[model samples]
Target: MRSTNFCLSTEGADVILATSSDEKYPPENIIDGQSETFWTTTGMFPQEFVICFHKCVIISKLTIQCYLVQTLRIEKSMSKDPVDFEHCIEKDLEYKEGELQTEEFSFPEFQATHLRFIILSAFDTFVSVHRVIAEGIAQDI
Candidate 1:
């Protein structure tokens, strides 16, 4: 199957909730397909953002681009609403100076309607998530 960027906001994915947001930075930027635009955390650690797909999809991999992020956790839910989520992946990222941190995670084929990405901690007090790309195939329910 062809891999597609399911996280694109124009593709019907949405950022339902975010713990912190600056006036110029919003969670929606995470799925906007541009690395220059990013969502910044305005407060403490343990920030989060939830993305809801238009429909169920079988996700194979995920790519995240961010700055100053240290620990990241991802959860998934198949329910229509963003609830009953199960743990998917968690990782501690390396810091890259003068550049964005790019990480790729591969997963067993699984279907989900919503994906929640949590920033448990960061290398800096403030963190910014540039983009999150989900490679998946849409499944007909």
Candidate 2:
């Protein structure tokens, strides 16, 4: 029953795709395990990023820290490749000026090798994700 932040880049998590990214705000920052660094959407709504874990894992919960994000949808995939993701959860966040939004999601029975988070919309022209933490254990499948 070890708990770990599977989203850390050091943990073999990777950001496979993103709609738009600024040079200073690359998607890799979201999983860097540092709150100071972050990833930002360059433009438009419906921005997305896919995270591939090192191996299949049973995800128990997730913590997303972002700013200016209005709506978010998450999907998970158990396939070896990043595809055929099924819906996991969707949430609408509350916005507070000069403050970061911290949202937590729990899924006791969720297992996946990849997770995709889609930013459906934002409260502002752009949104920034400071960090994403996935707490879970690697499954021996």
Candidate 3:
């Protein structure tokens, strides 16, 4: 049977933590579905954020839209809380000059309650994440 797909943000995933927070560029902007608005990091490299789903989900694919990101690493946590994540994937992004660098990862369905996205490095000092879309089906608890 083909399972229905959903975006984690619309499934109640929320309130992520960023290495640094700016009122004008809050982490929440990443899910607002607006390319013009984004979550920007300040101070240094290795900026990270965690998105917690309301419940466990079997994620089939993950996509990220951003700018200036050079390298990214993604981790997953099956715990009830956002802790103890295992490495899922790491990517070296290509620069697009003046466009968004969109990265899509298709994986075998896997269970997860939380996902961590770490910006390991960037083409510039700051990086902006425009949106994060996780396509999956929610697992019944």
Best by lDDT: 1
Clashes of each: 0, 0, 0
Looking at model 2, the pairs that clash are none
Ranking by lDDT: 1, 2, 3
lDDT of each residue in 1-141, candidate 2, tens digit only: 778889998999999888888999999999999988999998888999999995998888999999999999999999999989999999899999999999999887688999999999999899999999999888986
lDDT of 2: 0.92
What would the TM-scores of all predictions be? 0.97, 0.97, 0.93
lDDT of 3 by residue, 46-95 (tens): 99999888689898989899999999999999999888999999999999
Displacement of residue 44 (Cα, Å) in model 3 is: 0.5
lDDT of each: 0.93, 0.92, 0.85
Candidate 1, poorest ten consecutive residues by summed lDDT: 1-10
Q: What is the lDDT of residue 8 in candidate 1?
A: 96
CA lDDT of 106 in candidate 1?
Answer: 93
